[model samples]
Target: MTCDRLVCANCAAPVNEGRCPVCRASRERLQQQEGVLGALTPAALLVLLVALVAVAVLARSFAG
Candidate 1:
C-alpha cells in the first residue's frame, strides 16, 4: 500500500506526512520495498499485460 493512503496509528494522521516516528519508519520501509512495477496502478498494469500479450501474438504470427 502507498504511504499516502496509509494511516499512522501512532499519530492518527496520514503516514505520508510523517507526523510521528512510526509514520516515518513505516513510510521509509514502504518506499524501500516498492518494486519496479509497484508504482503502476491496477488499470495501468492490466493495460501493460494486454499490450505484452498482443506483441507476443503478433511476433508469433509473423514468425509462422
Candidate 2:
C-alpha cells in the first residue's frame, strides 16, 4: 500500500514521483500516515520481518 506503487488518476504517473499536485499531496499524506517506522527502506523492513518471524518461532517452540 505504499505510494510508490500507487497510480495517480490526475497524471497517470506513480504517486511517489510527485509528477502532479495530486501526487505530491497523496504522497505526503501517505508518508505522514506511515510515521517513522514507515520511513524505513524496503530492505530494512524485510529484515525486521524476518527477525520477528524468527522470534515467533522460538517463542512457539519454548511454549511447547
Candidate 3:
C-alpha cells in the first residue's frame, strides 16, 4: 500500500513523514519495491488504458 496515509504503529505518524525508524524502514522498502509501472499513478494508468483502447478500436475499424 502507498505510505502517504499509512499510520506508523511505532510513531503514530504518517509513514510518508518517516517520523520513526520503523517508518523510515518501511518507506525505504516500499520505494525499493516500486519500478517503472509502479511510478504511474492510478489516473495516469487509466488514461493510458483509455488511449490504448481508442487506438485499438480505430485500428480495427480501419483494417476491416
Candidate 4:
C-alpha cells in the first residue's frame, strides 16, 4: 500500500520518484494515510488478540 513500490499509471514511473505530476500527487495521497495500522504486521495483530483473550478470561473469573 506504500507509495514506494507503486508505479504511476500516467507516466509509467515509480511513484516515489515523483517523475511527473501524477506520480507526485499519488505519493502525497498515500503518505497522508493513517499510521502503520494501514500496514499492520501479523505479529502486532497476534499480540492484540492475545491481550483481548486475557482480558476476557480475567473478567469471567472475577464475575464467578
* lDDT to native, each model: 0.91, 0.92, 0.92, 0.86
Q: Which pairs of residues collide in model 4? A: none
Model 3 spans with C-alpha error above 4 angstroms = none
Which residue pairs come into collision in candidate 1?
none
For TM-score, candidate 1 versus 2, the one ahead is 1
Q: Write the per-residue lDDT of candidate 3 for residues 1-64, one digit (tens) a residue.
A: 5788889999899999997899999999998888778889999999999999999999999999
Query: What's the residue-level lDDT of 50 in candidate 2?
Result: 100
Q: List the residue pairs that clash in candidate 3.
A: none
How does candidate 2 score on lDDT? 0.92
TM-score of 3: 0.81
Residues 6-64 of candidate 1: C-alpha lDDT, one tens digit per residue:
89888899999998999999999998888888788999999999999999999999999
**Model 2 misplaced stretches (Cα beyond 4 Å):** 40-64
lDDT of 2 at 10: 95
Off-target runs (Cα >4 Å) in candidate 1 are none
RMSD of 2: 4.1
lDDT of 3 at 21: 93
Residue 55 Cα positional deviation in candidate 1, in Å, after optimal superposition: 0.6
Model 4: per-residue lDDT, tens digit, 10-62? 98998999999999888888877847686666798899999999999999999
Which 10 consecutive residues of model 2 have the lowest summed lDDT?
31-40
Answer with 2 or 3, whichever has the higher TM-score. Answer: 3
The true-versus-predicted C-alpha distance at residue 6 of model 3, in Å, is: 0.5
